[model samples]
Target: MSLFWSIYVGVLVTSNLGLAIFLYIYGTRVKIPIEGDGTTGHSWDNGHLRESVRRLPRWWAMMSLTSIVVAIGYLILFPGFGNYKGLLGWTSEQQVSEARVANAQKLDQMFARYRQYPVNQLAGDSTARQYGNRLFQDNCAACHGTRAEGGHGFPALTVNGDDGDFVVSTALAGRTGVMPPWGAVLGEQGVTDVANYVLSLSGAPHDAARAQAGEPRFKETCAACHGAEGKGTKALGAPDLTDHSWIYGGDLASVEQSIRDGRTGHMPAWKDRLGEDQLRLIAAWLRYNALTEREASIAAPVADARR
Candidate 1:
């Protein structure tokens, strides 16, 4: 508080306490002349009432004295007095700092153990998995969904799955997948043909000759980033076209539009937002989920494929 406010507060507090003390003391000892009728001479209500003079009740006096002493003790021990900062010298900043230290110490112990395991190995750990799950839910769930299954414009993590290096590389730094719009360059027919070709590469249904026709154009324009086979360059974060996974959509029209115009999906860097330790834990869980699901996919080839 400024000197003026501090002094103002001090004066008010002092006056309040002083008044209470004076009243307590005076109430007990003030004397009044009493008549034989056991009443003070003061009368009211047209003489129907006469005031009775008596000692302050012992209980009330004791309570008031206790309250005064407690208030004074509080002012001395804590921060009630203006600008004094109290005898304890406590501050909210100091308390928070102390709490942060304790919290860091606890987390450091858990993180130390986590560090021993690679992101892959940590996926198997129950404690790490539990922590990783919680961490992912808090940070990644908004975009990736509660189950990490992903949504429109976001890559499906569980579907066909990408390899560890691909996933980790994207997670660590983050990546923006850009398929620049080719609509203006390729006429409507060319866009449809190229989309069929991309679909054909993954063994999805397409007019084979049309797909073959589209290849020359695809090689001329798309091969550099998407690669000769359309499996995509992981280094470039060009998605594997051979995979069934699709970011925009896997349908025929969706693929055509993608080929004609293109699309971009941006995953922001979580490192600073979530902190290193937390991001690492979430990364661990994603790594775990990816590996387990990929294995299961291979083991159970789509039933239709078996035929």
Candidate 2:
């Protein structure tokens, strides 16, 4: 608090305490005239009630005095009298700092054990995966779905069958996925044709004539980042156009807009935020889930053949 406010508060508290003390002393010592029947010269309800002066009860007076003493002691030892940090120099911030330090110390021990193994190997560890899944839910579930299946613009952690390394590295370093605006380069019709062609790669519904018209244009312009087959390059963070896993929507209008205005997907670096060990744990969880999905995909055909 400012000096003015501090002094003002101190004066207010001191004045209140003084007033309480004055009231207690005056209440006990003050004498009043009494009638012969041991009642003060006051009556109500046609003399059925009469005011009687009585000494303060010993227990009540003692308790009140004790409370005053306790209040004084509390003010002296703790922060109540403005801007004073108290005898022990305790603060809410200091308490929180101490708690965080203790929590970090415990986490360090757990992380040290995790550091001994690689992320892929750690994915097989049940206890590690459990911790990782919890961390993922807390941090990543907002953008990536609860099951890491991804959302409208957010990329999936495991859904597209991406390797653990890709997810871990992306998290550690961060990435900005930018599909530049092609509206100026390719006119509105060209943008629509290209969107249709891109859709055809994934076998989504598209006008055959429009796809044919844009095929050559796509090969010339987009084939560099997105391969001729539209498989996409991992290094470029270019999404696989052939899959149903569309970062943006798979609809013709959505695809056209993507081509016209373009899209930018950014994944914030977690190296500093999560640290190495925690990132590895999260990567392990993602890998384990992806592996499970892969296994399920493999088993499905076998089970179908048996049937």
Candidate 3:
């Protein structure tokens, strides 16, 4: 603290403590004059009530003295007195630092057991999954929904066929996917045609004539990132065009805007914020959810056949 502020605080503290001490001492020792009726010359409600002075109660006096002593002791042993470092030389920052170190050590011990298993295998462990789910909710749930179902402008985690290693690596390093604008090159009509053709790839509704016209153009231009079959390249983070999944909406206008204006999607790297073990835990939970969804999908077909 600045010298002026420190001295100001010290003065304020000393003045307050002095006033309290003075009040305590004077209150107990000072005597007040009283009438023969033993009441002070004060009354209310047509003299039904009258004020009287009495000695300070013994218990109240003792408690007040104790509180004063404790306050002085606290000031001497702690940093309450302005810039005094205190006899113990303790600091709030030091306390927080020590707490963080202790917490990290405890986490390390817990994660040690998890290190033995690969992320895929770790997904099968209920305890690990519980931790993973909590971690995912804390870190990943904002972009990927609580259920990992994704939202507009965000890819769904559950549907991605990514394995644990891929998930972990991506989380650690991050990824950026850029779809360059083809509006100027493709012209207005060409943009509409290509959008329709892209929709056709996913079996979404589209004009047949426009789709046919845009096929050659799509193969020539878009096939580099989105495969000729429109299945996407995972390495490039290009979403699979053949699937129902759409980072933006799957509607016709949305697809046209994407082709014309382009889109950029970013997944932030977590290496600085989260350790590898924590990332692996998140990957494991995601894998578990994906597997569970796949199993349910498979069973639904079998049950439908029986019905």
Give a tens-digit lDDT track for model 1, residues 1-307: 8998888888888999999889988888888779988897789999899998677789998998999999998888777667878889887889999999999899998798877666667667778878978987887788878777777788777642324444555666788878888878878877877888999998898988888888988888889999999878766667778877777788889898888877888878765666667666776777778777778767777765888
Regions of candidate 2 where Cα sits further than 4 Å from its true position: 23-63, 160-162, 184-189, 292-307
**Which stretches of candidate 1 lie above 4 Å from their native place?**
1-71, 80-82, 159-169, 202-210, 296-307
After superposition, the stretches of candidate 3 with alpha carbons farther than 4 Å from their true spots are 45-48, 296-307
- Candidate 3 on 100-206: residue-level lDDT in tens? 99999999999999999999899999999899999999999998889888899889887672389988988999999999999999999999999999999988999
Residue 257 accuracy (lDDT) in model 3: 98
Q: List the residue pairs that clash in candidate 3.
A: none
**Best model number under lDDT:** 3
Residue 91, candidate 1: C-alpha displacement in angstroms:
1.3
Q: Looking at model 2, report the run of 10 residues with the lowest lDDT sum.
A: 156-165
Write out the backbone clash pairs for model 1.
181-261, 183-260
Choose 2 or 3, whichever is better by lDDT: 3
lDDT of 2 by residue, 168-281 (tens): 788889998889888898899998899999999988999999999999989988898999999998878888898677888899999999889989999899998897788888
